[model samples]
Target: MKIAFYGSSLLSSYWNGAATYYRGILRELAGRGHDIVFYEPDAFDRQQHRDIDPPEWARVVVYDATPEALLRVMDEAADADVVVKASGVGVFDDELIEGVMQRAKPHALRIFWDVDAAATLDEMRSAPAHPIRRALPDLDMVLTYGGGQPVVDAYRGFGARECIPIYNALDPTTHHPVEPDPRFACDLAFLGNRLPDREARVEEFFLKAAALSPEKSFLIGGNGWDSKAMPANVRHRGHVYTAEHNAFNCSPLAVLNVARDSMAHIGFSPATRVFEAAGAAACLITDAWEGIELFLKPDEEVLVARDGQDVAAHLAALTPGRARSIGQAALARVRAEHSYALRGEQVDQILRDRSASITHRQQQMERA
Candidate 1:
């Protein structure tokens, strides 16, 4: 199958959180003999901070953030077996959604892949004329990186033909245990771009924890946090590139996963960092959210915190041996059950089933 995916940068994790998710799933899909073409707009200085070159597994077309460039990419994607318009492309998102519905060949599978389904669903509900709401009925399927049943049910309520949650998983080849580096060594580290919805949570869960545990070292790595107020024990490394993520994850005695307000409220949406941290055998302490047990075992594989106090308590209680044991357990679990290879196979089956169903329906119409 030839899959044309329109998404945020695949080559850059600068301000885009979905870059690793895209690389993991698409790379696995490509390994299964599918041709993948990724179309990302050159916007938000992402091109200037690319982490990887055009990968061998997928063809990446970086287009200008202009109407003409969008049209050109849309035309190029017309012949694909599957056409995906992902959420948060950061430019011309509505146009791309409409274009997938309007321009793709009738036989092509049209997918609205929502990397941030919780927020997207909220937008659709608030705005009746949202492009995804209008396009839902015509799209063959809606695939989400997270937001399990809540997202599926919400999309169905909006008249989607089908919806599925393809949760984030570890790509062992891309993210795994690496030797700890002194530059990133810390008691706890959190990596996420600064966004309005997530900033408050970051302060509460990360910064507050650091303040409470004054003796422990903490690190923050991501874009847009250079000016954020933090405790003297905390260090901020703005915009750590993807290449250094392994070191960043491995060096920290434990890593943190803070969900955006929408994702936490919606529940069941695991951030990509969770799997990345787990793959690197990093003990993870995550803010409390529903459905985490479905991915990693609580108290054994991961530590769940209800607030900053809980985070501080977890850090205080964690000894080096206990942390190492938890990290290893999480790593083993993800490797056995949540690898991208498993996810890619699930996606392949979904695509095949949907295509066959479409063919069967068409044959019935012909007979009628």
Candidate 2:
């Protein structure tokens, strides 16, 4: 299948949380002999922080956020077997949603891959006549990064023909344990861009923990934290590139996963960092989120922290041996069930099933 995907940056994870997820899924799909072209806007300084060049598995097309670029994308998308416009492109998203539907119709299979399903649903609820609502019924498939049953139901409520969850998974090949980097070395490390939805959680779960554990070294890797007053124990690295993720995870004594407000409430929404840190065998401490047990067993595979006090207690008491045990267990579980190879197969099957259904409908039409 020739698939054209328009999403956030794939080359640089600069401020894009979906980069690793895209790389993992696309790489696996390409391995299964599918032709993939990724379209990303030249915004967010992603070009300046380019982490890797276009991979042999897929072509990465960086386009300016302009009307001219939209025309070019529409032309390119018309020829694809599947054209997907993922949520949260950080630019011209509303326009892209309409453009993909208008141009890719009657030919390419149209899919709206919602990386942030909860937020999109919230938008739909608040504005029923939004462009996304207008586009929903026309989509051949509505796929989500996470939000399990709730997301599927919400999309279906908007008149989607089909809705599915493509949860974030581990790419062991790219994210296995690596030697720790001294530059990022710390007792606790949190990597995430400072988005409004998650800033409060970062303050409650990450920053406060740092303040409480004054003797422990804490590291933060992401952009948009220059203005915030961080605890003296917490060191901030402006932007961590995609290539350094494994080292960044391993460098810390333990890694933290802070769920954004919407995602935590929606349940089953595991951030990409959760899988990355676990894949690197970093003892993971995550802010409490529903359905966490579905991914990693709390207090076993991952430690669940409800507040700063919980995080501080974990930092104060967790032993090196215990941390290693939890890290290894989490790594083992992810490698077995959450690998990109598994997700790629699921996507392939969904497409095939949809094709069969379409064929059946055509045959029925012929009979009539």
Candidate 3:
């Protein structure tokens, strides 16, 4: 299938969380013989900041996202088998969404891939005034990155025709653990951008952990964190490129994961980092969530931390041998069930089933 995507940013993983998710999923799909054209805006110019060149498997088309520019691409959109409007594309102008739907071909599939399903739902639920609130029902499919069950329920409750979770996954060959660098070899570290909604939890989980273990070095990476009043023991490394991520994840004694508000409440939506760290056999101490057991075994593969004390307990008490064993177990689990290959296969299965049903229906109609 030829699929076109409209999302926040692609071509560069520069300080953008969704970029990593897109790279993993789209590249994997391409590896499986699917064609994808990712339509990003020239506004962000993510191409300039790219650590890795865009893959040969997919094409990156930069658009203006204006009604006029979209109309110019109407023929391409109409020719594609699928057109997807992803969440948080930073350029998801209301007008653009409407324009894409208007220009969609008769056979073109439409999808709303909500990487931030929980956050989107929360925003829409609180303020019906938001533009996206009214656009939900018009989407052909509502797919999410996180929010396993609750998010799907919420999307369906909002009258979406179909709701599915694509999830964040690892490409083991790309993410598996390598030798740690001395500079990145901290006791524990959390890597995420400094966003308003996630900062408090970072403090509650990571800062508290740093405070609890004054001797243990804590590392923080990602952009927009210069102003965060981090603890004295915490090391803030502004932003690391996508190429440096695996080294950063594998170097620490254990990587810390702090879920943003949406992920915590909606559950089952593990961040992209979780699978990356797991694939690298890096020990992980994550803030507690409702459906984590489905991904990693608590106390064995992953350690769940509710607060600073919990994080401290895991770091201070966990033996090096036990940590390695747990990380190895977690890596094995991710390889078996949470790789991007797995996600791509699942998507293929769903698309194949849907296509088959459509074909059968058409045949029946012709016979009648």
Q: Tens digits of per-residue lDDT for model 1 on 1-368?
A: 89999999999988898998999889888988899999999999999999999999999999999999889998976789889999999999989999866888877888999999988988988999998999988999999988878888999999998899999999999899999999999999999989999999999999999999999999999988998878999999988888898999999889999999999998898888999999999999999999999999999999999999999999999999999999999999999999999999999899888878887887898899
lDDT of each: 0.92, 0.89, 0.82
Ranking by TM-score: 1, 2, 3
By TM-score, how accurate is candidate 2?
0.97
Looking at model 3, report the run of 10 residues with the lowest lDDT sum. Answer: 67-76
143-201, model 3: which lDDT tens digit per residue? 88978878888888877888999989888867888888877888998899888889899
Per-model TM against the reference: 0.98, 0.97, 0.94
Per-prediction count of colliding residue pairs? 1, 0, 3
RMSD of each: 1.0, 1.3, 2.0
Of candidate 2, the 10-residue stretch with the lowest lDDT total is 100-109
lDDT of 1: 0.92
* 1-368 per-residue lDDT for model 2 (tens digits): 89989999889888888988999998988888889999999997888888888899899899998989867886788778788999999998998888877777464678999999999999989997888899987888899999989888888989998899999999988898999899999999999989999999999999999999999999998899988899999898988877789999988888999999999998899999899999999999999988899899998999999999999999999888999999999999999988898999999888767867766777888899
